[model samples]
Target: MDLGVKVDNLPAEAMMELAPRVEAAGLDEFWLIEDLGLAGGFTQVAAALERTRRVRVGLGIAPAAVRNVAYLAMEVATLARLHPGRFLMGVGHGMPEWLSQVGAHPASLMAALEEVTVALRRLLDGEQVAFHGSHVHLDRVRLAHPPAVPPPVSLGVRGPKGLDLARRIANGTILAEGSALDYIGDIASAAKGLDHRLTVFTWLSVDSDGDTARARLRDTIAEALVHPAMSVQLRSWYKADLTDAAIDALAVAGTPQDCAAALRRLADAGADAVILQPVRGAESAQIASLAEDIRPLLDAG
Candidate 1:
């Protein structure tokens, strides 16, 4: 299993510092989040790639609804050509509210996502795309300079239909933060026959005291409970209460040993890569612990 750390929507400058740290620590991948108002995904990815030599850089998702498919393909192709096998791209349906706020929500999010992903992949593969779907319309569009080796494109989506679409068109599936073991297993099972990568993002917090570490995630867990995608994963364990066990199921928290065990469970449940997302104030320390403490335990086990 590949281990990675997410630079979650942090300031752009954070990459200059964090990317090298991740590579020095021997992490396999460095991921970035591209929320609506945050730093641009492509920009951060370029900066991270520029700063690091080994660690693979990924944009956990660029909202397909807002970007034209051809333009998105160009940006991805440029990065792939420059970095070769070191870039991973994720495209998805943007958050409904966020898309609406920006006046970019499509009439059919699923159609838009599918169309964009298909066209984007085709363009990356150096195909001349002439597509006329419900949402995406292109007439003989192709990249001027396609990558010799195309980058992997994953779909960041939650619903069943979206997952099915990912299976059909994407190289991988990106499960968001708060993904539980059962959910991961289910996704893995569904992709049984295909050569698919299941990349899971889970919350991470670590300290000498396991209780203190777990406690730090309470507020974030409470907030996650309300999101539709997160709630699906938590609902099986959630019954009128949020208990310690439930928290353990959702996050890789606690002491080094505890965090290692949590990550192991995720891997055993079929996670190709488990991306650790640190709680807000504890980013640097958690990354260090993940590298120095948790990872060694996992390696030994």
Candidate 2:
């Protein structure tokens, strides 16, 4: 039932401004994402963690294909040591086009992810790793300075195979934006019997004026639907319904009461944490409403 806000596409300067606001507003977590050619996740996370004293900072994911396992482990360990109990580290398969554009996409995603997660975890746990997998090759690698406590590692993945791998190997799972309630339930069922954190990002907009909230939310969903992951996944699950603008069901928007109710449903469906992602330029206002209006309800319930 942790409440978080996703800082998607926010610039570094804005993050510096927003991180404190998020903390001051009483939000529990501030999550960020690293896309191809955008700001680096580790640097942004460092800035956010430095700026905030209480709220936890997280990378929704940094692509595994683009980083060496040893280097990734080092970066994570450094942050964990510097900011104990306050960083959630997520890594997984990035977009295929982006990965291929950079010539980093693996031939077999399953093999690459499995190898990376295992090696990365071992390295973070201060174990000497000598891995020689198809995608990752480590030669008796061990961190010079490992954190006494390892940071939580989550995979940003979807589909049955990917979820299975995350459940088996990683510490947690991250469901991407626009995942339906039924879909979340399916993932929850999959996540049972394991001590995994199920973090989900849903399109979010909340205002006292319900119309304004829904309109802004619709715009966000419109953009989200065009993303390759959302498009393919929604079409596969909803099929003909996707053609009818079914994005509303995938999003949560309205007045504070409405938004809180939607979040309650997600919590009931087994979301360990829900990160509210606003449409472009709507982040600050949404964060305020989440902190002031919506969060209290979730807290009370």
Candidate 3:
């Protein structure tokens, strides 16, 4: 089973220990959230690269509004050169508030993403693109320090339109773990000939106190739980409520056995790998238990 962690991407001191430990756990990748709440995505990747060798580090969907493709392409090229096969970039329609904070909201998300993606590729392939698209008009857009071999690009999208875009353009997609593989069936089939990596994030907990675990997770991931895409889909499938508190309460709030069952469900949903997010404020005992005590169950598939 391919496993990874959803790290806070803050506190450089934390990565020194966490990075090596995650690598030691034999996880396949480390996906970093832009701790715009704390630091930039590039800084997090740099810190992680310095600590681990084999485990890949993903700048997991840095805020699209915060970065232009030109700046992002350069940083990605630099990281690939520095870390070789150890870095990937995931970009997407970011937090709504964060986009407003930057004073830019390109009306057509699909067009904005498409333009940036095309321009970034042209630059990375060692070509200067004089591309003028509605969202981004590039005249002298080019990369001088492009890597000999560029890093792979990933996108995060939930709807069919975005999924189709990922299928058409990106190497893969990075996602917060979600179930309902059937929801995006045609999108994945569209990805048949290409190598589109699916990295799903799930907040996992395993303990006897199912109520406490669920409560803690409710508080930690409340915002995400009620996100439009997540809640809308959940409500369609189950009796899951769409309100913030209710959906949050539903996020991975169960016993280790229960959480394991859920992961199995998601894997069967067509996830290639799952990045487990441990519940917030969990004790060392809990962390240790999750890491050492829980044996792998059968493949969810």
Candidate 4:
């Protein structure tokens, strides 16, 4: 399995700086999130790709409801042509409340996400697409300059139905942070007969002392456990009370050996790539440890 990191919750300017650091650290991929008001995923991806030569850059997700499929395909094609195999695209249904606030929520979230993903992939593959689904409509649209090597398109979603949709249409699936081993294993089991790739995001914090590293993630884990979407998935996967002890299964935290073990467990559960999302205040240090410390342990293991 490959290892990667996400530029989560960091200031927009950090992308330029972090991109090089991720590459220099010998990580395989660097990912960017497209939150409601954050830096645009496509723009950040373009900038990061321009700044780095080797590391693959991914848009962990761009909401399907907001962007028009044809135009989105153009943006994707432009980046793919420039970066080729170095770009990975992920699209999904936006958060319900956030989408509603922006008036971009579709009546049928599943249909909208499915339609957008299908159309986008077809366009990127240099095929003329005429798709008319619940939320996406295109009239024989095609990209004039499709990349010779089309980038993989993953779907960022959680839930059985959404996972099924991803397996049917996308090249891979992106699981959100707080995805536990059981959840990943179940998803992997379901995809056992296929070639679907799994990219998992998990909160990360590291210290020489295992307890200290886990302590740093206490508040963050608590906050994540309360999220509507994450809570449902986590609660279903974990029967025990949600506490610091649960951190080992839910996140990559603790000493280098502990973090390495946690990551290896995720990889064993069938994650193709585990993307570390650092704790808010300790982004740089956590990443440095991931490269200088945890990575070597994983390699040796």
Q: Please identify model 4 stretches exceeding 4 Å from their true place.
A: 235-242
* lDDT by residue for model 4 (1-301), tens: 9899997666778767889999999999999989987898888999999999999999989999999999999999999999878999999888888899999989989989988988898998999999888898889898999999888999998988999999999999999988878889999988898888999999888999989888888877777766776754586534455566788878998889989999889989999999998878677788889999999998898
Question: For model 2, which pairs clash?
Answer: none
Better model by lDDT: candidate 3 vs candidate 4: 4
Q: In model 1, which regions exceed 4 Å deviation?
A: 238-240
Give the TM-score of each candidate: 0.97, 0.94, 0.83, 0.96
Can you write out model 1's per-residue Cα lDDT over 98-137, one digit (the tens) per residue?
Answer: 9999999999999999999999999999999999998899
Which order, best to worst by TM-score? Answer: 1, 4, 2, 3
Instruction: Give candidate 2's whole-model lDDT.
Output: 0.84
Each model's RMSD to truth, in Å? 1.2, 2.1, 3.6, 1.4
User: Cα lDDT of all candidates, in order?
Assistant: 0.89, 0.84, 0.67, 0.88
Candidate 2 contains a number of clashing pairs equal to: 0
Ranking by lDDT: 1, 4, 2, 3
Which ranges of candidate 3 are over 4 A from the true structure? 9-12, 177-181, 184-190, 208-211, 220-229, 235-253, 283-290, 298-301
Model 1 vs. true fold: TM: 0.97
Colliding pairs, model 4:
none
As for candidate 3, its clashing pairs are 35-38, 177-201, 206-256
| Cα TM-score of candidate 3 | 0.83
